[model samples]
Target: MLNDIVKNLLKEVSGIAEIPANAAFNIRNNSKSEGRHSTENIDIVPKEGGSGLDIYVKPFTKNENVHIPALITQDGVSEVVYNDFHIGEGAEIEIIAGCGIHNCGCDDSVHEGIHRFFLGKNSKVVYIEKHIGEGDGSGKRIINPQTHVEAEENAYIEMDTVQLKGVDSTKRVSSAKLGPGATIVIKEKIMTHGHQTAETSFDVSLDGAGSSAKLISRSVARDFSRQLFRSKIIGNTDCYGHSECDAIIMDNGVVAAEPEIIANHVDASLVHEAAIGKIAGDQLVKLMTLGLTEKEAEAQIINGFLK
Candidate 1:
């Protein structure tokens, strides 16, 4: 079953699913919420509706490399999880959250997650999330993720999201507000194939002096897949913001990259850049001449490009 597959993979990726754990983990198995455990200084409370979790970290606590895995496996099942996080001041933490979906039923399966984070002053938070979908079923496996972040003074927030393969469709949206001397960085990587489609939108506001944000996205569309990347960053104070979108399109695939920057203050600065193109023939030929097969060369190029 997908539960077993995902559990094993999660263990390999994050080291452990449970047992001797320091941080908390909540696993959603085919619309069913499973056990969750946490450390002493951390609080993990299940929401009233059983579809979400409320998490709080004590001030001055350092929680590093915390693994929280959520898995969804079932045909025709639709599961939604809401995670509300409040990180205390002077605390540094890392979170690993990934979703694996396996659908073998004729009906389409979907998972939509909403996550919100509140960063306290002088704190640093790193969040890593990965989504994977796989099955032999005729139905589509879909995942859509939405995130919101509010960073206080001197706070740092870094978000990494990756969608490797097998998802039929996705629409992702993320927004953040940065306070004075706060920094927010977002990195996204996605790959789509086989008639799939994906769209992503990011909105960021640097509202305080010395606040800054960077939004970067990399995607590959192949075999009739389509994708759209859009980001709009606004600087309202003496801040700096930048957004970049890059994509490699192949095999009749289509992609659109749109980046916009808005500066409201004279001292504020913003920059935007986007690029979408197919794989370079010369690069592929050179790799192939080095004793690599065409397919191997293509794979190597994509792996390096995404990395």
Candidate 2:
């Protein structure tokens, strides 16, 4: 059974309002395991070092979903967890993960999560993660996340990451190495406001022939907030890579985008795009002409852009 706070945090992060009785899941709260379940084709086992869990997906498994979410409810608590995923050959799965923090005391609450994925040949996986913070206290909410991926030949992986709201400070990093014929796609969205700061870094190495990678990020900064985005793609063989960053700034906010691409082979191809600006006047005017207020129009535009 989950308490009200844990339930709410679970819902906000992973959209799991009620725990599924027949699905694979591991819910961690304040560095402790709240609940766990394992399916026939998927297994979730705690690590021997007491750090995190090792999730295994059997070969040829399909249409399976796994949820691993963490929450921090008490103030002045800090923890680091390491979770690893072993994806078997020919398996296709979806993993849902996120973290939420609720602090009401005069001390900072922090959680750092490290995730690594090892993909077998011809496997495919989609991973989604979201972060949020909530409270009325004077303390800060801090979260740092790191992800590493190793994809074998013909494997494919897609990562979707979002920072929803109320995070005071965050630094996110992700890196990947791809084998022959492998591919990876990453999409990230973030919103920062009220003196908050957010930073994101991504590095991908196309180590084999026919490997490809694409990275796209969109962000909104408002009310004195600051954001920075850095992306690097290195092609060691004949491969393709692309990176893009688009941002909107408002009300004294600041945003920076740095992109780097390196082609070590003659057949390697790479491209990068970055754009940072405020909301367009014509967009606001069109929405206002349709019976919307200025604030409402701005909110709608931001929502659409992030989506």
Candidate 3:
């Protein structure tokens, strides 16, 4: 049933084009099946080599939701890879990827995914990723994703991410070099409730002159949850880079944000900024005086802070 749903979703996105050929593709499940609602129940493995897969992925036409639960374990070293070729000038692509998990049982899950783009000169791409989990399941999940983007001169790439409510999640990320006169923008928003913990990090660099990079991040934590975000932008030669982080805290919640910007050349320019705070009590009180209940006022304050 999950496979059918994914295939239908992919078909809706594929539109009139023929399904890309799948070659040298494999899937393995070795762990005991966790309770229902596992992501491992549904998996789509892309072939090693593919053609006609260079087209852009537009944003979802409307709101979409995907929920699943699964337990996957790897005894020895294992890996998963995806490779694609995209060659187009003055093109644009927007993708929205999201997932929700209710339980993972006891088995640990590891996901290592890669995306490669052969962008043409003056092209633009925007990618958004979201992850959410629920319940009191006690299992570990690790996600390591690498994106290699070859942006030609005057090209642009924008990446955004949002992670909400997880028990124990760790994400490791990587990115490639940007071409001359290219620009890269990154924005992230994360929220955690309950006793969950999450750690995520990203590393990006501008390898060509006249390139520019920017990162903006916001995190909110409640209950006993802990969240950490580490981001770095490096400017080489005559490039420019800037990064900023903002966080909100509540009910013994803890959050740490680290933004690092480095300039390796005399002509390079870099900047880093970060802020951490809690919802203003006076603001909440003022709202409560306006006929709103305490719960409503607190929710409004948090919504405003995240915005």
Candidate 4:
């Protein structure tokens, strides 16, 4: 049975209103597995001698999704977990994973998660993750996530990561290496306010011929919050790579974006773009002419920007 708080947290982070009877899932609460289920094509096995899970997707499988969500409801608790995903050859699947924290005490709560993905030849994967925090206490809510991806020949992987709001601090790190004809795309969105801090870093290597990678990030920092975005792309063969970072800063907030690209072969191509600015006055004026207040217009703009 799912408690109300856990259900709400799961919905907030993973968009799962209730546990699905026909789907594969592993629900983790307060560093322990609360519920787990597996399907014929997908197996969720506990990692031996470890506090994590090993998820395997059978070869040639398609149209499946696995949910792995973590929730923290107690204060002064901290945990670090490792999860690995093995996508077999020619499989097409989606993975939804996230973390939510609700701490109502003076002590801080933290969750550090490290996830690795291994994509076999010709496999395709869509990965989505979201992070959120909620509470009325002085305790801080912190989450740190690290992702490592290895894509085999002709594999494809798309990742969408978001940090919605209320987190006091976070550091997100991701790295990927692509094989021949493989491709990887990553999209990230984040919002931080009220003295919060967030940092993101990405490193991608296109090491095989005809491989490509794209990384794009959008973020908003408000009310004295601080944000940092850093990305590096390396093209070691005949490949293409691009990285872009865009951010909005407001009300004494600070944002910094750093990007680097390297090309080791003559046919390698790489590019990067970064922009940091506040909301445009013209946009606010246009929205306000529709009878919306300044605050409403700002909120609308920020919502759209993060979307």
Candidate 5:
């Protein structure tokens, strides 16, 4: 039986529809099999150690986006997943995957997922993933994720990762390598509160001539929470790379922004910008003047910034 929390989480991380017959869905370590679509274009295999699930997409597959969202609703439950995807030559597709934890137990629950993508020549892919946790229990919620990407010649990839709320701690590391004429854009968003901690690091390399990379990251922290944002972009040959980081902090929270740009060749173009500060008092006051309580006004401000 699905709890209200898990159901709402699925709706946010994935979509609020019936699980497609051809979709690969998993919870904890179990994969739904009944009426599930089993297409030759994609592969979902069990890890040898019964730890998680592995996903792969074959060449020339233009199928719809796959929803592979997992949930941890019980305390004392820990989950791990390692997903591998291969987008074949000239293929274009979208992938949506995420994890949500609703803990009501006395012990901490944790989720760690590692994902890798291999993009074939001239292919394009869009990927979106989000994480969230909710509950009033004494148990803690933690999420750690790592992502690696390799783009072939002329390939293009866009990735969006989000952490909405309720995660007590998290550390994310992401890196990508691009080939000639390839391009990649990454957008990451994070929010932390109530003594939580969140850290993210990104490393992107435009290794081939004419390759390009761009990274945009935004974060918010409040109520004594801590956050670390780091981005490193490397440009080789005649490639170009750019990175930007923006953050908002409140209530004695600690926020750190570190952006690095590396140019290995004289023709390489690399640049970066970073800004971290607390929420503007005027923004909060303006919202409160619209007949909202101070708390409600703050919430609206944060939501608008994240949106």
Candidate 6:
């Protein structure tokens, strides 16, 4: 009975716009309302709910500019997914995708979120994704975002992600890809506390000649929280790739970091680096001597590390 209602709602939502060609989308809901969770896969379509800012994407055309801004709100146990972004050639586009999840007065509830993108040759794309959790309670939420970028020669892509705190939350994964003569840059930052767990993964492949990829990641874990990061750079042709993951663990926290670089062709150049350690005790002591509280000094160290 509940499934019938959700199906009806989705049917109404689908009536808002036509699906793009060469695109595929899928979303599933395990449970709804105050129960398990709800998940959906939605293509970039016109606004139908009169929210004016729900989901928006402008296609790239010759000498034309495009901007996409989307805001998603989850009041309870719900999941949302976005898949397959179709970008045209020689065009420029920007996307700002954000979500706010408040799981107040709920327990054992869940949320899942995903995003994917595909780019054409000689195109430029800038993407920003932010995930935030608020309210004081013991509920669970997971966020997983994946990006598939097919940039033609001379294409450029830049991606940034930020994850903020909520009780018992997890950041499942994040990833991207790059084509030949294509350039990609990725930056990720995360913070967690209060028995939370965060995990992030990125994989970038350079398949075109002279293509380049770069990734930088920073994270902070406190209390009984934990974090894990994995970054991989693969160069299959005459390409170059570099990746780095740096993290700081504080106060009984745990962190595991893995960074890998692979070059399958003789002309390929790749580099990978990772660092996981606690805040410097001497620095903390010096800050404390400067009349800062211990907690404040710790926060300063973490902020500096991420910078």
lDDT of each: 0.85, 0.95, 0.58, 0.94, 0.81, 0.62
Model 5 quality (TM-score): 0.90
Clashes of 2: 0
Error of 1 at 145 (Å): 0.5
Residue-wise C-alpha lDDT for candidate 6, range 76-172, written one tens digit per residue: 5544444346666666765544444444555544545455556777878787766655545555555555556667778888887777566366655
lDDT of 1 by residue, 1-307 (tens): 2356666655643456443344566666666666667777678888888778888877787855555566656788887889888999988988777677777778898888899999999989999988888778998888898999999999999999998898899999999999999999999999999999999999999998999998889999999999999898999999999888889999989999878888889989998888899889999999999999999999999999889
Model 1, residue pairs in steric clash: none
Please rank every candidate by TM-score, starting with the best. 2, 4, 1, 5, 6, 3
Task: Kindly give the number of clashing pairs for every candidate.
Answer: 0, 0, 7, 0, 2, 2
Instruction: List the lowest-lDDT window of 10 residues for candidate 3.
Output: 33-42
- Stretches off by above 4 angstroms in model 1 are 1-3, 12-20
* lDDT value, residue 275 of candidate 6: 80
- The whole-model C-alpha lDDT of candidate 1 against the native structure comes to 0.85
Q: Model 5 — which ten-residue stretch has the worst lDDT?
A: 29-38
lDDT of 4 by residue, 152-271 (tens): 999999999999788999999999999999999999999999999999999999998999999999999999999999999999999999899999999999999989999899999998
Model 6 spans with C-alpha error above 4 angstroms: 1-76
Q: List the residue pairs that clash in candidate 2.
A: none
Compared with the true structure, the alpha-carbon lDDT of candidate 6 equals 0.62
Residue-wise C-alpha lDDT for candidate 5, range 194-224, written one tens digit per residue: 8899999998988889999889988888888
Worst 10 residues of 2 by lDDT: 1-10
Model 2 has an lDDT value of 0.95
Name the candidate that leads on lDDT: 2
**What digit string (tens of lDDT, one per residue) describes model 3 on residues 100-128?**
33343555445454667666777776766
Decoy 3 TM-score against native: 0.71
